[model samples]
Target: MSLFERFEKSFMPNYGTPPVALARGEGSAVWDVDGKRYLDFIGGIAVSSLGHAHPALVEAVSRQVATLAHTSNLFVHEPEILLAEKLLGLLKDPAKIFLANSGTEANEAAYKLALKYGRREGRRYFVAAENGFHGRTIGALSLTGKKAIRDQFGPFPVEVRFVPYGDAEALREEVTGECVAVFLEPTQGEAGVVPPPDGYFQAVREICDSTGALMVADEIQSAIGRTGHWFAHQADGVVPDILTLAKGLGGGLPIGACVGFGEAGTLFAKGDHGSTFGGNPVSCAAALAVLDNVDLEHVQKVAAQLRTGLEAIEHPLLKGVRGRGLWLAAVLTSDVSAAVQKAAADAGFLLNALQPDAVRLAPPLVVTDSEVQSFVDAFPKILTEATP
Candidate 1:
């Protein structure tokens, strides 16, 4: 039996079954089990920040593993301390961090902090934007506003109020004084790279301030230089009380962090929470390498090239392109996103159909100019071939 068939018979049905069975990757390219090479535009759903098998990432992980692979939270390690300091430096704020194993765990930690802070003030309600995705864990899932995934989970553990995204008035109206915190994504990744209106976050910040609610920004897919900024919320020029990060932060390793600022930073007292393998030495080292190697200027240039190329496409099936930096989505005139994804895959390129009409592209930050141009040139042809 083929690898795909073997996977279907053995693995769980959560992800269904992906068509390609990749064996190895280098830079912005990956080879399937059968040795078919494809330009990877998805970047493992924006997790591979420096691209696959980057020399720096490989070396860092190797060196760290040789020295020390992991030390539970009961012990303190230099790599974890260094990573936390570096993250605080990048954030340009004084904050305390709780490390975890993934974005979901980070958000879960943030949620618990918010819950504890709320309980102190007799607050019982939380707020989140409609269509915003936090994570799959219970606390994070309760904050997630997507009904399709949330409905089946059945009666979450918290009372969360949802507001229309980009609508400052609705958010202001919904986030009353009873709200403990408001969770939002600076740019919605799973919802097809949707960015809110300019200054929308500023309004949300103001609302949170007025209502005495903590502002939690889920920058899982938009942080670590993904949007040509250290953090997507930086574009809004506002500071969130709690910032959750993952995805590209570890460069490919599994790591997540919940950073709390000011009073929120002190909300989690000793013995409040802990993680056994959250800040594994090897993962922290890999993250340090990614932070050292990512070129923000080059990433911005590539993002501009992608946006210009997509906007310049004159195909009738193409509608428009949206999103910032390398985190982009191509809107189709029709619901042919699945076909477009398949055609692009067949044409030796890989991207994601975030919706029936939205194709998402979040290539690695180290993706070369030529690689992006190749995708630009092939996009129209893929759309044409996929059109019915």
Candidate 2:
């Protein structure tokens, strides 16, 4: 049996069966086991910000692994400290970080903070927007608004109230002092890269402040220059009390963080929370490499260019394009996003159907103008074949 067959037989049925068995990747491209090369627009679900086989990431990981790989949280490491300091330096003051192994773990740490903070204020409820995708863990899953992901895992701990996304009035009416936190994503990535209404984040920030509730922005998919900003909340001129980050933060390594600002940072006592492999030196080193080599200017310009190019496409079946920067969702007039995804893949490109009506694209930040042109060049043919 092949690797795919072996994987299907050995692994749990949670992810279903993957279509391809990838062998290797370089830059914004990958090759399957069958040697079929593809323009990797999905970017490993937006995690490989600098693209696969980036020299910086490889060198850093190699050096760190040769020096030190795993050290329990018992001892201090330079990479972890430097990463925390560097990340905190970019944000507003009085920020503290809790590291984890993945986005769900980061959200789990934040959830612990909320539960502890709620106990202090005698509150047990958490508020979040509808269609929001936080993570797959139990605590994060509870805050997630998607019914399908949560229907099987019932009886979550926190009482969660789902408000209509981008509706400030609904948030204002729903948020109470008894609420622990109001969670939101600046752009709902998994839900077709939906960008919230103008001033929505600012309004949510105000609501959270006035109601003595913590505002938690889950930027696992939107942070790390994905939206042409260090943090998507920055675009809205709003800052959250707590932020959860993963996906692109480690530049393809498994790392997640729960960052809290001001007194919120002190909520977690020494024994409150911890993770064994949260801040592994190799992961931290790789993340530093990504941050060091990332060209913010280039990422911003390329994303703008892509948006313009995609919008200018004269395809009738293409309804609209939503989102900012490299993060984008192509809205189709008909519910044929899966067909479009397959068509793109068959034509030597890779993309995702985030929803039946929306196909999402999050290419590597290093994707060049030529690559953008190639996708634009090939997109028409792909859509023409997919559209009925």
The numbered model that scores best in lDDT is 1
Provide the TM-score for each candidate, comma-separated. 0.99, 0.98
Clash number for each model: 0, 0
lDDT of 2: 0.91
Candidate 1 on 287-367: residue-level lDDT in tens? 899899989999999999989988999998899998999999999999999999999999999989899999999999999
Q: Which stretches of candidate 2 lie above 4 Å from their native place?
A: none
Give Cα-based local distance difference scores for all models: 0.93, 0.91
Q: What's the residue-level lDDT of 145 in candidate 2?
A: 94
Task: Estimate candidate 1's alpha-carbon lDDT, on a 0 to 1 scale.
Answer: 0.93
Clashing pairs in 2: none
